[model samples]
Target chain A: MKRIKSKTAIVAIVFSLAGPLSAGESLPIRNCTWCHGSSAQGFSTAPRLAGQREKYIENQLLSFSAHIRDNPLSQQYMWGATANLSPEAMRDFAAYFSSLPPKAANDGDPQLAAQGRAIYELGIAEANVAACLVCHGPNAEGIREIPRLGGLSHAYLKRRLEQWGQGFHAAAEPMPQITRALSPNEIDALASYLSFVAYESLE
Target chain B: MKVIGLRLALPAAVLALVLSAPSRADEMGGPGFSSQELRAKLDYCKTCHGLSGQGYRGYFPMPRLAGQQPKYLENQLRAFYERRRSNPVMANVAHALSPSMVAALAAHFKDLNTNPIGGAPKEPVALGKTIYELGLPEANIPACSACHGPEAKGQGEIPRLAGQLFPYTVKTLGNWSKERGQGPAKDDTSFIMAATTHNLTQAQVAAIAAYVGSLR
Candidate 1:
């Protein structure tokens, strides 16, 4: 009797550790967490989904399935992930991930942060670069369909910016044109600066 | 000897006229800008203002310059430059523009007639139309059509209200006194709107903004 009770308690602990999955026809969140990390904070090349704009994530999922976001990593990973998702599933995932609190990566070069801040705030007007704050919001919190940029990983942000200039993700308007104007050093500065920014600190 | 001097004087006079003609033209239009320079500048403007100058909704709503009166556009640019308008970005942009470049840009934008990028709430539209067409007599407001023309196309220094962005109009009307006529010198036109803006309630302003924004 004692052995049987211990066995039942162990099983219960294991089940609780796994957490409860959402009821209904939606895909298991583990399918995304395997690559996105258990916390949805992101891992490797996958970006942090937590605290991202819900509409932006939903739009990107649709873009992936449609083959519009054709960057190499997206093709290799997100395309398959989003391929068979229903509209409701997409909305559910977007709402779920975006609701999670985000932590700043804080992974940038301290020396270059000031230059990056200046570029982000005011832009290099002489070079015809429009200020990022005009579209990205003052604290980089994003609005409506725009994605939050403050706490995304440096590598991910850098890759995305570079991809725009490389002719991938051509459908994201104004970005292709905007990124084309940024030099490699400027891209580094921007990505580095953004990685270190804590969204809460600014708020 | 008189004939010899007359021949010398005639060539000198002709040469002087030929040399001064280009400079006089430059004086009239400010300085000459190459087509390439003008095109580049226009693209820069479009980055903030929409591609067709139709206006854009960024974190801040950029106003439509397309089909606007060149005089009004020029006056605003001058206002930005003179610190009469308190927009840091526009001040930076306006400061870089030569008078001829400003004229070229104004002319270029004035020719672009595009549809309004509409996104305002629909409920207030009818009320907006009424307010735009007929002023509230008890509130001492005059009909907007009186100055903006029946179609809101505006004349001289008055801006074209047709197809202006909803948020841009709202922000402009709400902050009229704070943002405009800010320089040491008085701006007569901006002053005229100050009393009118002060009198209208927030709802009335939204109605007018919505009505005008819906116009093509």
Candidate 2:
């Protein structure tokens, strides 16, 4: 694990580089922090990069680098700009970022989140959706290639669902078919569930 | 806005055409993914991924790997094992499967019929459709179909959000945006999400998540 001081030093090293951005190594913090945050804690809009699985991070980096995972809003400047970077750098950066810890989510509407939690645990019958626990796990923890949803951003959640509704499926596995059936109200309940509910476990 | 929806599927259609590959070495046109283990996993995965592995709909997001290429499946499985793909939660699950098992799972998924995952009859579905057609425009949010495709299927860079499981979508989105040291989904995608999330609200998100999950 990287100590805060060490991470600072690494950033310092990157800052100290007098030449152009290195392709063989990770992208300088400058390019990364715009969305990830200066400390890589991520902001209200994004999830934490620290304390994440390294290989997962690497794959996503590769997706962006390869243009396999593109965001209409973000890709224009972030991923598209970094596509030229070497694979080694992508891995190194993924390793470095994955090693960091996540920033905790701030206080939200616990009751509303709890209301959302009910839907997460058990799906609405009229909607015909499965319980969130069926695939995500009982505690909102995710399954293989599936991510957990606790302590995330209200704003971010909103956009993603819109993306899903409108049909943005950057995720590799099953998401392509998943968003097809969602309705706006359901998106709201789920988002509330995530924003307000505290996940049972982080691991 | 209507024009945008009309154009939504162009990318996904093109993607399907591009990914349509010739048969690989020694293998027939089916189950062309990584390994046989994946085929076995396919049976196990059907509970959530659907019989065809296309997934039930927005709430499932399990992915429809039925005819995906071996290289892509192999790389994805390996990436999950090595933690080079998607998010930590998936990486953990992917890692649990043995190499051959992952390959077999991929193979199984690749062999399934993706048609089941195809477009549902054009009707009013719910959350996904509402959001897709009309974003929180006041929030300055963009409709997802603009890039993702009208049917919620995806193109190159974009994935198909339809039929994705509720948990996968919720969790992955959280992982990408919920700050550092939070949970398993951390990584660079977090950055991409930051800018995108700027246009949304929590309640809206919850509704959409459920809507997407409801796809049968």
Candidate 3:
């Protein structure tokens, strides 16, 4: 795992040095596209950044730089990818990516979508799960520093929720507290529902 | 032989009395809910209210529950269940709580003495303080201290204004008549503030909200 990270870091550094040859020009889009996908649609383990909240992307980039987002993938990939990025460059990257239209992953169980919708909208009050819409918005379009959860892959959404409870990234306050109340079934329902949410891009 | 039988019967009677005793003070809900169960419920409340019950800034502002009067808390819970208060999420939450659970939850939040969350604008604070203490007599607004208490800690069903979330207070005061006192049959305590809330302008409400929200 360490070897792979070092190699990725070396390639990232080389890419940074070889970038498009002018300050304030287009961000080295290729450097990110290599793993984030040619269209920035997220490939393999990478989370989709397209049409995400600009402030959220900026905050996450800062989190990477500060080593505050300590999730395994964030530690392995994003730390190196963002390590050499200047604050101006990070802001530019975030702004550029946030404007692009995002596609729904649509990769969760179809049968679970209804249950997920119920949980997201109403929450399981008897179980003490607060409605996700209270903070995430009715359509799961996040505000400000909160990332948009709509149309993210089920695996990505599920893992992020589970990781908070597992004590991975402690910096995202209230998430650890919030997600702790969700049962495993609730998580699956939420992930499934969110995966199917139709994209509503705010250009 | 009869004396021996009497002696044995006396011990049996004492054992029966011990078995039928009311039980320990802290063991609420008897065998129904453990201390762990109550703690879980408290954690749930804290998720939006903040870990220390200091309030939080979600998409919709969640009010501070720390240092709230237990009577006020319990009344609000019952109000939510009874539809006298009009928050859909809270209504659902209140519906699920039993009377004992409501009492336990209310008492639990009342004792938490966390600091104010503190996000109100500083510009209006002085004006807010003046309004809070002195009121706009020309406007016929009674001093808030008269009802909310000097420190805004509140009494009985009035609810504590101290350390409340600015937005929550603003929304509550702004939408007082629309949201609260809706059930015609149950007039409730919210009506006491209806005329006051009605007479206060938006600026005055903001000022009062900012002032009280800054209290410890």
Candidate 4:
């Protein structure tokens, strides 16, 4: 009788636990990490999704999926994974990745930081480009449609600007025209400035 | 007095109607969208363009793809890829992608739902209303709806104007004033945008930008 009761109780507990298991329960990782890196921070020239806004990340991936946004330079590499992301998977993926804290920006050169700051706060007097701060918010947290540029990795920022110049529309927004006006020097300066600038507020 | 009128009008409501309409004739659809749809999985082009391979409106000059057929979207996608299309920026986007990916993308957006995102904003949207109704006579800019339609829903080649990434919208207009190829559309009709912005002072640009941002 004791053995029978113990076996029944074990079966009951196991079945109860099993029922609660959900397909969505996975972290959306554990696979694809070899190239994407364990932290989802990206490897080589691929992007770092760690701590990114899930909506934004998903939006980018969707662009890849839908082809609204593409990078010929990087196309062959990403399509393999981006293809499998269904709309549902995209949302779950975005939500999963966006929920985590982002990695900190790399420590940068102080001298370059000051130069980049001046350029960021005040555009080249000759180019007529407005200060990024005027539109992006004083703290670079971004507002509405513009993106937060500060504290992002320099590599990411540089690549994004290069893509923008190359006509890679984020598609989620309309900046290709604006990006068309960005000179390589301006892009470099902006990327450098944006990388080291700290976000002064979260709100 | 004009400021007072802006304070009274419901621009956000009007903007929603303008943004959620169908895409243009030679194109696809409007800025049809919803935050809920986007948040779901990010895989839906229908979240804005419409299901059944239709396109919708967003920004200026971008048209609807719904019912237009994926073949056309594929062609445009090809144009974007090769630069046969005049859009240098869109070309870069197309170029970065593979033909297969482009086909899939065109298929999705062409098949996504056509709806506005979470209703439109509840903001007063006053400034946008002014710009929509009245021309910047000082700058010789015409009423927005003349080509764009009421509240900027758009018609023919004109595009839906609400619910866009406001920064991109503002930047495109501003860039059109500065760059040659980066106008409102794939075609040269973007001359309209260059003309409208021709006389705009920085303050006018900022005002219109704020108003437009308040929309969708």
**Candidate 3 residues B153-198, lDDT tens each?**
9988878999999999999988867888878755578887887868
lDDT for model 4 comes to 0.51
TM-score on alpha carbons, each prediction:
0.85, 0.44, 0.84, 0.43
Candidate 3 matches the true fold with a TM-score of 0.84
Q: List per-prediction Cα lDDT, in the order shown.
A: 0.81, 0.54, 0.81, 0.51
Report how far off residue B32 is in candidate 2 (Å).
39
lDDT of 2 at A168: 50
Deviation of model 3 at A82, angstroms? 1.8
Order of candidate numbers by TM-score, starting with the best: 1, 3, 2, 4
Extract clashing residue pairs from model 1.
none
What TM-score is obtained by chain A of candidate 2?
0.70
lDDT of 1 by residue, A59-100 (tens): 999999999888899999989999999988999888877766
lDDT by residue (B4-85, candidate 2, tens digit) is: 4433443444234325633421232234344233323343455455655666543245555554445556655555555545
* Model 1 stretches with alpha carbons more than 4 Å out: A1-27, B1-32
Off-target runs (Cα >4 Å) in candidate 4 are A1-27, A107-109, A143-146, A170-173, A198-203, B1-216
Each model's DockQ score: 0.17, 0.02, 0.25, 0.02
Preferred candidate (TM-score higher): 3 or 4? 3
- The residue ranges of model 2 lying beyond 4 angstroms of the native Cα positions read A1-27, A44-46, A170-173, A196-200, B1-47, B51-216
